[model samples]
Target chain A: MQRYKIKISYDGTDYSGWQVQPDRVTIQQVIENAIKKITGQVVKIHGSGRTDNGVHAVAQIAHFDIETQMLPKALLRAVNCIINPDIRIISISKVSQAFHARKSAKSKEYRYFIWNGDQVTPFLYRYRTLIRQPLDVAAMKKAARQLIGRHDFSAFTANPNREVESTVRSLGMLKVTRRGQEITISASSNGFLYKMVRSLAGFLIRVGEGAVKPETATEVLNSQIRTARVPTAPAKGLFLWHVKY
Target chain B: MQRYKIKISYDGTDYSGWQVQPDRVTIQQVIENAIKKITGQVVKIHGSGRTDNGVHAVAQIAHFDIETQMLPKALLRAVNCIINPDIRIISISKVSQAFHARKSAKSKEYRYFIWNGDQVTPFLYRYRTLIRQPLDVAAMKKAARQLIGRHDFSAFTANPNREVESTVRSLGMLKVTRRGQEITISASSNGFLYKMVRSLAGFLIRVGEGAVKPETATEVLNSQIRTARVPTAPAKGLFLWHVKY
Candidate 1:
């Protein structure tokens, strides 16, 4: 069997999430169904990670093993043609047998978009989180700096479905920038816990609103307590930006 | 009666268009219904112009008269509170009785967005027209220059419901700019004919793709013929950017 890595992009608005469930529609299930029709085999593709409902993806990486001898270009075209319009298979390439989508990933970057405006533009209604309250971007930026290194991010994780071995993760980057009424929070890390990025977004927004102090990030990390964590930002605002090998 | 000039914005992806039609939903109908519910009176609201099906607007100007004693701010809040999320009443101000929504307009700026990319993102699925072909931006810009200034634009208008008295319209500006895979065509004119911008978009795209010569605009204007017009671009790409008085 040959392993093929595929880069995907999807609008996760109508999807339950990435993983397949008993009766719910999911990004993984949709693609798998398309693959099953094409190859006439049950193909289980492994995603780098699962995104929550309503979260979007610009470049999600996944891999699957197949015995078919089809070329990479033909496989990409065939899969994309059969899949839903909301999901796109951007590229596909043959990877080594040892390449695992989740385990081999060096880092993943997530972006959270906030429309810090009085009204949400209809065109941007599905993508951004509109906040009526004015944000202190400077405070948010300062809070981001406190999360730049390795820490036991247990406080930043949401309720996980399974028991996690460890919650320690290294942050490669984190920052906030504002353009017009749009505020974007970009975060990159070697690994992330389930809903970690969403939790971070909520915590930073509270800092921006002056509801929490700028040093709240450091306090939460040092304490390593989940009870002090802020509410998870809405799933619509989160996007899986990139998965780097 | 108090005349109110309101600036509106809407996502036209779901509605039929701006004007009311039998057995169809529209931006105007939704707003009018909101007004009717707020005031318990039948009122006629006049829009600056009609936008075709699936055409969006960021700053469309319109006027309506009401006998309510409520202030402009209260009226604005009440109307917006009831309208659907896809449509937004941006601002409302009291206008003189002489301000007619259609006749009092000076210039209208329309923007057409093209996602000239290999793949369309889910976030921008409803807004931009995706084109897979590589377009010549320089050629498109040159063709746009030929459409500027006063000329008989008979060939640009499509399927007008009424016979136009004169097809001559002064174009203030027309240009194309690209940001990454997104190409925007911004057109400002004293007025536009029915589906005029869409016609222009189709014409420019043909020129960009080398299907039509750059000098075709001049030839079409000189001919003063309606049958020589190119195909109308899709309605989803066109937006009423602004209505200036």
Candidate 2:
């Protein structure tokens, strides 16, 4: 058996997230179906993480083990041919059996896009969340700084499907930058709880909107309890940018 | 009657061409319907030019005369609210009665995008034309220079819907530039013949692929007849970038 690690990019507009479900079409199910058509083997592929529906990915990593004689390049082409054009297998290579797609990931980066304009541009409506009111970037940056270290981020996560051993996470970076009418919030962490990045984005946006003070971020972190103040930004603006191994 | 000039932007993937045809959904038809809903008047809007089906626009110009009490800003907001999200009224202003969208235009610029890569990025598939083979950007640039001048460009235009008095057009600029895996072909002219920009792009692509010599552009122009060698590029890659009046 050979394990193949693949780098993928997908526009998740038409997908029901990355996980496989009973009836809904998903990114995982589509890719797995394409692999089965190419290799004639039913295999379970593991993704780095599950992205919510309508959340895009620039470089999502995954791995699958199969008994096949085809080279990684040829398999990549064959799998891509069978899958929808919205999902592309960027590159594929053989890996050791021990290298799990999820467990082996060292750090992950996610970026949230906000169109801080009176009206969202027509071509950009799908990729960005529209914020009609002008945001205070300075306030957002100050608030983002408060969340940039190790802490129990319970206030920044949604309910998980399974029990987690711990909610403490080392957020390596949380940066907010704006160019023209687009604001980008980039977050990097060793690992994140369910919906944590979107929660962070939403909190920062509230700060930018003057609804919440910048210093309030520390109080929310110390509380470590989920509250309405930390809303989850829509999935469409969030992108799983990269997974570093 | 107030004559209003509007700058519009649209993602043309879901609509027919700019012109209205029976049983076909078009950009003009949608905007007209939106105007009727807003003002209760059936008014005809004149576009600077017609874009082929699937061709996008960044700043397409148009004008209409209507009797209404609403201010330009209010009318802009109301029309946008009624139209599909894919089409936007970027700006609207009252123009003089003698101003015309098409007749008064002095020059127009169009841009064509080509993804000269192994595969088109998933998020950009609708906006770019994918060419699997690597293109010679230097060669394409050399060929493009030959098209930048006043000339009788009979060989470059497609079949017109109506008879034209002359085919002579002042080609102000024809530039080819590449950034990473994407190539942009920009054309500016006093006026373009039907499908002229796409025809130019197609011919230059053939030259970049080494299928045609760079110097052959002059011969094709001098022939004063359309030939099978110059295929029209797909409308998906074309954009009505701007119209200068």
By TM-score, the best candidate is 2
Name the runs in model 1 displaced over 4 angstroms.
Answer: B69-78, B222-224
- Tens-digit per-residue lDDT, A1-245, candidate 2: 99999999999888999999999999999999998988899989999999999999999999999998789999988888788789999999999999998999999999999999877777888889999899999999999999999998998998643335988989999999999999999999989998999999999999999999999999999998889999999998999999999
Model 2 global lDDT (CA atoms, 0 to 1): 0.92
Note the DockQ of each predicted structure: 0.56, 0.70
lDDT of 1 by residue, B1-245 (tens): 98999999999989999999999999999999999999998888899999989999999899999898778878877887777768888888998999998899998999999989776766676788888798899999988999999988878888544445878889899999999999999999988888889988988888888888887779976776666448788988889998888
TM-score between candidate 1 and the true structure: 0.91
Q: Show the lowest summed lDDT stretch of 10 residues, model 1 chain B.
A: B157-166
Pairs of residues clashing in candidate 2: none
